[model samples]
Target: MTPDEFTATYREHYPRLVNLARRIVGDQATAEDVAQDAFVALLKATLHDEQTVPRFLSVAVKNRSRDVLRHRKVAHKYAPFETFGPLSAEYALSVALFIDIIAALRTLPASQRRAIVLRTYAGLSEAEIADRMGWARGTVKSHTARARASLRRELAEVA
Candidate 1:
């Protein structure tokens, strides 16, 4: 599709995506930022089809929410790497999953989580995320891969 079409899609879907992001990210400002960034990426995309729009949006929102969570965790100095041990395995797994998601997210150098969230949650095309992030598509793909791998490894160790 043409640039105009992309813009129109962004306009139509941005509010919905923002609402979704707000639910996960838990604030208005960060939600707006995530929505804006996602739509900006969508605006820059070559929308060869429209059927995948929902998927694209979901990924973007999820990715952005995760970013906000990571930022909040770091800004608050709530690092889980510090030993707070002696919890049981089940409780430990639950807590670790929560912390693991946060720690894995913090481990990302920003770009990786962007790619990971977009791909895994928002279901965005790598090309679209790359276009939005202004990186090569392959870079988007690898960042996603690494992010997933890291999360799995980190969570498993805690488990």
Candidate 2:
């Protein structure tokens, strides 16, 4: 597609895309990143089937968000070695909280985590999520349900 077309598409879909990214990544800032990344990808995107532009964008945005979440999961998995050489007290406290939250999130299976993130963080409808994640709608629903149950079990002791 042309640059103008890409821009038009991005403007049209930006809000929903942000919502989708937010659900997948679990934060406003990260969601913005995902959405922005989608737009960037769209700018340079060249699909063999130009008719499916929207679908391509939807999948790209979701995949970007998933990548962000996967990165977080990986980071969380090895957080014990994270360091701030000149750490202030507040920084140390923040790092500790980050580690704890990551540890808790790690309790869930990958599918459940992605499902929860896509539903809650990205604010995507189940149908949209199913399309983006390339999963059956019912499977997405089941994963979210399981994620919620797992989250409850993990967070129950936190508070």
- What tens digits encode model 2's per-residue C-alpha lDDT throughout 58-155? 89888998788789888887777544246788988887767766777798888888888889878999998899989999999999988888787776
Q: What C-alpha lDDT values do all the predictions have?
A: 0.81, 0.82
Give the lDDT of residue 150 in candidate 1. 86
Candidate 1 TM-score, true structure as reference: 0.44
Alpha-carbon error at 21 in model 1, in Å?
1.0
TM-score of each: 0.44, 0.48
lDDT score of residue 125 within candidate 1: 91
What lDDT is reached at residue 147 by model 1? 87
Candidate 1, residues 89-121, lDDT tens digits: the string is 898678757776878778787888788888877
